[model samples]
Target: MGSSTGTARHSFRRRFTIVVALVAAVAVACLLPRWWCGRDADQWYRGDPATVRGLAEEMVAFEDDDDRWRAGGGADRVVGMWGLLAHQMTALGLAQVSLEHPEWRDRYAPVVTRAAVKSLLPQLRSEFTSSWHGRDGLAELDSPDGHAYLSYPALALGMARLVDPAFPPHLAAQHDALIRAFERRLLASPTGLLDTFPGEAYPTDVAAVAAAIAVHGRATGTDHTAVIAHWAQQVRAVQIDRDTGLVIQRMGGDGRAHDAPRASGTGLAAYFAGFADRALAEELAAGLFDQQRNLLGFSAIDEYGDGHSGAGDMDSGPLILGISMSATGFALAPARAFGHREKFTRLYRTTDLFGLPLRSGDRTRFATGGVIGNALLLAFLTSGPELAR
Candidate 1:
């Protein structure tokens, strides 16, 4: 009886080991694709120029569809906030693409640049439509002193200058006017920042506008050193979050910093701030790194640095295991820009796994993301040297 029991136990052990081995094999098979695909994070950054062009081409198509949605399907089809920001970033991406591949100007000028100017520029201007408010309600984009609409105009026009010397002279005139508007807004601000929604200013948006002004200066051989110095000082004085030491999310026009640092605003502001003050950009990025960095396998950013989940908004998108998806995705731009290669690589890998990309013919897009998401992704991937003087 004892011998029989021993034999039976050996047989069961063999079966158990076989089952364990099989399970292990299956797991490896399932996980290998993700590892192989994502092992090299820079793969996305090394995209073909033609593919980059296709993203811009595809964006125009998507924008038309969005307009149609607003016109026919749902009054709620309106895009706002981050969506509008992507509209501006898309145009900025196209501008950078045109600059990097000057030989492709023939294709870029009319297809990307002019199309962007015609469609998205007006959207950013918010002509009778609302971009700062919710989709259900049309909030006018008419903050005279510190309007958010003013940010992208400066960015798109400054980028337009890089696209072609023959870009319309009137556009350049418009660029100067926008800069003047920004200057007026800056001088008028009690807090030294510009507002996106009325009475609410975000450091990220203001930093972008500041960078655009600097880019325009470089493109036009005009010096904006004095203005930038004053503006940067104001930002430092009022925008830094005491807890995290990075830029805050929203400040009142009366100058109260409302939220602690997060990946979304800090990343974007830092990327653009590099144009005006690389030092400031570096400082913010360093602070962000100390607060947000998660170095286990794929890098992730905590939505709030001090574990404070103060409030989650559409801008933060969905949080994954306490990490903000939008913050992680959007932060890729500045992270890559500032030479945070290891972290950038990990973030890009995460983006790739979650992005659900689609590729056909010459075009590649993230299936799960809308026009804004893809546009922002394109902006992150195709970023090149600055036009900054």
Candidate 2:
């Protein structure tokens, strides 16, 4: 009996050791390839626009429902809309790039614009008009918490305007109303920076306000210069991390700074560049854009650099740690449009590829995912801003 008991104990120990070894081996195997492939920054820029365009189209085609559009199969969500809109706009920008590389433009622009109008636009408008009470003069959107869920729609609206000029007229009244809603519900005193909402505020959503403000400035060409400037100053005072050039993800209405820099917040650097110091935008871009890896590896900061933290709310989609293509793409594209050439070039060289070889529906899906990627490439293709003589 004693011998039998000893033998059983030894068997259990052996099994446990084997299990541990297998687990460790599997983990290393999974991580080793990524580590090996991740080192080459050049791998990021597989700059074939035709391939990129095809990916964008695939993303749009994969949308089984008007409401649901994620890169991988997922439910219809806000980020999908934002991602689609940004993707279409990037394609329009890429048209100029396709001018030189005519092969890319002929394949992408027609389909991209078509997708924008037929699919992306309608969903965005519905979200604005129906889901949110923006059209009903109900300043704040009707969400569970009673906020308009401003950032995502605001960014989408801004992008849509670029895609279709008529979009602004259709939504103008609502647009102005949304702005006023922001003022009444989300604006905080002293700083004048808007919050996610009046009481329950997200510190970083103020950047969304900044984005809306910048869009208004560009779209209307008036009434926004001073307002945007003031908001940018107020936002910078409360949220910017001077040392790292990152911004706090959120702050209390009472004006205390939190310590996390969201991709959305950092991404705004390029959009907000025109209103604030150009150098600051450069700093923010540098701190935020990690060009060292591919899609799964290129995310921006989640709250507190939490390894597995994500933007799962209305503001973002499933986040893979260490890279945020969505955020970095948004930042780089706008930076390019606004004439931050050096930053644009760096981002372009580092992150200029999308789903290639046609594994999916349309290449614009990759374009949508890599909106900044297209934007950077487009900027390279377009004429540069003239320097002071």
Candidate 3:
């Protein structure tokens, strides 16, 4: 009986050892690609010009084909929004590179110009607005009835002008008009927030409007100091969440919170605010950083701050263990902008691990990231001080 027991024990040990080895091998298989892809993650935040150039070149190539954006199984509104975001982000990224590295200005100016123009295409706006609001977003831009989303394209136009002062005269005029319209409406609003759609006021979109005005001022030497300052003051007074210190994700027209303060909105708001108000941007960044989670050297921003928990929606993307995909992704820009080296590196490693980067000669694109994802990554990775002057 003792001999039989010993043999059974030995058999059990052998099986356990084999299971352990299999588990270890599987772990290595998963981690090896993450480590390999993320080997140079720091190069991105460190402003390696060659790294920036490669991604920028890839974005330009992708944007060159308008037909590449097709309405697939997803809703047309979602696809259109992605297409618009893709173009706006591409322009912003290229413009930022031109501002930071003047040596590349000549090569990227035309690309920036093309992206800015494409963002304003009526068909694109119609596709998005018809599905979302049952009307065109670009229509009646001068009306104060809340077309706050237009601020994105306006900001792109302003960036294009900043990069190439010789921007076509007509386009330059349109940029001026947009700046004036935002200024007039913002100054006229009692709560200092504008609705992105009817009855839907998002502080993030309002932040973009302020950024658009500020960039337009820089590009044209226009004085929007009063407008920006007033908007910032109002934001601090009403739009910020008392508990989290982050901007409220969604607000009513009266600046009342419609949803929780979330990292996705806060991170993007910080990126937009960086162009206009450094202090505001930094404040938002600090709040956002407080919500970050680090595990095994990988960092992700939680969608909700401490004391808040919520399910994922369209804005937050999928939530994995409460970590938000959009929040984590959007946080990259502010992480780099605010000089969070460790955080940026870890977050970027996470991105590289999941992004599945595939490289060709002088070009690299993330296999999982289509045109919109790639463009947004380029923008977030390249984000720095506008005009770096």
Task: State which candidate has the highest TM-score.
Answer: 3
Clashing residue pairs found in predicted model 3: none
Give the poorly placed runs of model 3, Cα more than 4 Å off: 1-37, 67-79, 131-137, 386-389
Ranking by lDDT: 3, 1, 2
Query: How much lDDT does candidate 2 score?
Result: 0.45
| Candidate 3 local Cα displacement, residue 122, angstroms | 2.0
Model 1 C-alpha lDDT versus the unseen true structure: 0.67
Q: Give the per-residue lDDT digits (tens) of candidate 1, residues 1-389.
A: 99999999999999999999999998897677547546546654554566566676676566566557766865423344455565566677776677766776666554344433543334434532353443311122223546654576567667767666677877777677777677666766767777666667888888877887788787788887877887788877878776776677778877776766676677667667877887777777776666555543466666677756666776577777768777778667667666667777777767777787677776678877777788788777666435322
Residue 159 in model 3: shift from native, Å? 0.4
Each model's C-alpha lDDT?
A: 0.67, 0.45, 0.82
TM-score for each prediction?
0.81, 0.53, 0.87
C-alpha lDDT of candidate 3 relative to the true structure:
0.82
Q: Report the alpha-carbon TM-score of model 1 versus the true structure.
A: 0.81
Q: Count clashing pairs, candidate 3.
A: 0
Q: Which stretch of 10 consecutive residues in model 3 shows the poorest summed lDDT? A: 70-79
The digit string of per-residue lDDT tens for model 3 on 1-389 reads: 99999999999999999999999998997777557756877889877988888888898777655535433433233246676788899999998888788999998988888888878876566644754567664556577766788888998998999898569999988788777888999998878899886788898999999989998988889999999988889888988887897888899898778888889899888889898899988888888888889876788888987778899987888899999867787888888887888888888888887787777888878778787778889888888755321
Candidate 1, poorest ten consecutive residues by summed lDDT = 134-143
Compared with the true structure, model 3 gives a TM-score of: 0.87
In the range 1-389, model 2's lDDT, one tens digit per residue, is 99999999999999999999999998887666445433322322333545444534443343333334444575444343454444434433333344434555545445434433432344444544453344422332432232434544554354344334345365655665565555444443565444344343454455455555555545565455555556557656766655555666556565675435566556644444422234445555555553223333332333223332444433434455545545544555444444554444444433443322214433432334344333333332231111000
Better of 1 and 3 by lDDT: 3
